[model samples]
Target chain A: GESVGLHLPTLSVQEGDNSIINCAYSNSASDYFIWYKQESGKGPQFIIDIRSNMDKRQGQRVTVLLNKTVKHLSLQIAATQPGDSAVYFCAERIDTGFQKLVFGTGTRLLVSP
Target chain B: NAGVTQTPKFRILKIGQSMTLQCTQDMNHNYMYWYRQDPGMGLKLIYYSVGAGITDKGEVPNGYNVSRSTTEDFPLRLELAAPSQTSVYFCASSPRGRFQPQHFGDGTRLSIL
Candidate 1:
């Protein structure tokens, strides 16, 4: 079955430093991708998204880079902060006559102050 | 605005018990979805509804059922609860477009013993 996965289960970074999270997807038919941030005891919050036609998209201090040829996606956060410590997930939108998102296992981002 | 609201922030159920997780969105989105997340893992789609009176099964919908009687509400029902059903459930809603970002609720924590 086609699925999405993360390269690292955890990522550690110091405050004010840059952090990057990587994700790999197996479905070539997916056209849209999204990044979500989940804090403790809360739901996943939408961060940034990019479409297949566009290779990159930026919002606030976050940027999402999509590589269709490699089936890879990456999220880069600038000036990491303590509040950024949480789990990050990447999801791919599969259009099966309807919209469906397939999520990755998630990468835990730990920012040290 | 209360983007999305989920009832009973936490719940406990015994084996064979049944319960419904309620979800409602005030944003008037046309797409609603239910997903379950286990510890250290990503969310798995349980079910989704595109509009009123329209529903479809997702990746992990075996023990779950859903209905969308109105555009603002989509509830998920679990029958014959088992230990495997213990997880964090989140409800999300998006606009009519396939590229729209989803707004999520806080989520409900369920423990089945």
Candidate 2:
């Protein structure tokens, strides 16, 4: 079955440094992609999203880059902070009719102060 | 605005016990979805509702049921709970558009013994 996966299970970075997380998706039919941040004992929070038509989208200090040809997606965060320590997930909209999303295992980002 | 709210932040159930995880959104979103996340893994869709009186199953719907009687509410029911059902459940809602982002609730932590 088609699935979404992250290249790294965990990423470590120092404060004020730039951070990038990579994700790979198997479904070519997916048109929309999203990034979510989940803190300890909490739900996933919406971060940024990009559509197939657009190769990149930026929001606040975060940017989402999509490469349809490679079926790859990446999220870049600027000036990493301690509060940014959490699990990040990338999800793809698999079903357009009902807008179903398939999520990646997740990449835990640890920002050291 | 209480984007999305889930009841019973935590719960414990014995094998064969049944319970419902309640979810409601104040955003008036037309699309509601339920997902379960196992430790260290991504979320798997359990079920979703397009609108009132409309419901459908997703990737992992077995042993679980759902209903949407109104636009503001979508509850997930787990019957004959088993150890496999132990996970963190999250409810999310999105607007009418396919490209809209889904807003999530805090989540319900369930442990089945």
Candidate 3:
């Protein structure tokens, strides 16, 4: 079965440092990707997104990089803050008409002050 | 803006019980989705709606049913609930196509014993 998996289950970083999370997808048809942040006992909040046509998209302090050649995606957070400590998930949309989005297992990010 | 709202923040049900999880969005988004998240597991798509009257199954739709009577509402019903169905359920909406980032509700935590 095709699946999207993260390279790490947990990440620990110091506050004010940069953070990077990676995801690999087996589905080649995935044309759109997104990054979300989920705090404890809360729903996922959208971070940033990128289309297959582009290699990178930047948000306020977040940047999403897509490497379609290897079906890899990464999210970079500048000046990681304590509030950024949460689980991050990468999701992809394989079929445009279906409006379907599938998520990865997630990576727990812990930022220590 | 209360982009998305879910009712019954937490619920506990006995085996064989039935209930519906309510989801509403203020953005009047045309795309709505239902997803379930188990402990230490990735989010799984339960069902989705492209528009007010169009609905479809997702990755994990066997034990759930959804109805989208209006663009603002999409409810998920669970009949004869089992322990396996116990998980945190989230409802999300997006303004654009499948490629758009989703706005999610706080989520409903369901426990079936």
Q: Provide per-model DockQ scores.
A: 0.57, 0.58, 0.58
Model 1 pairs in collision: none
Off by over 4 Å in 1: A1-8
B39-97, model 3: which lDDT tens digit per residue? 87788889989899899988899889999889999999998899999999999998865
lDDT of each: 0.91, 0.91, 0.89
Reference contact recovery of candidate 1: 0.62
Score every model by TM-score: 0.95, 0.95, 0.94
Off by over 4 Å in 2: A1-8
Candidates by TM-score, descending order: 2, 1, 3
Candidate with the larger lDDT of 2 and 3: 2
Candidate 1, residue B95: how far the Cα is off, in Å: 0.7
- Reference-based lDDT, residue B63, model 3: 81
> What level of docking quality does candidate 1 show?
medium
lDDT of 3 at A72: 94
Question: What is candidate 2's CA lDDT for residue A76?
Answer: 99
User: Sort by lDDT, best first: what order?
Assistant: 2, 1, 3
Q: Which pairs clash in the backbone of model 2?
A: none
**Alpha-carbon error at B33 in model 2, in Å?**
0.5
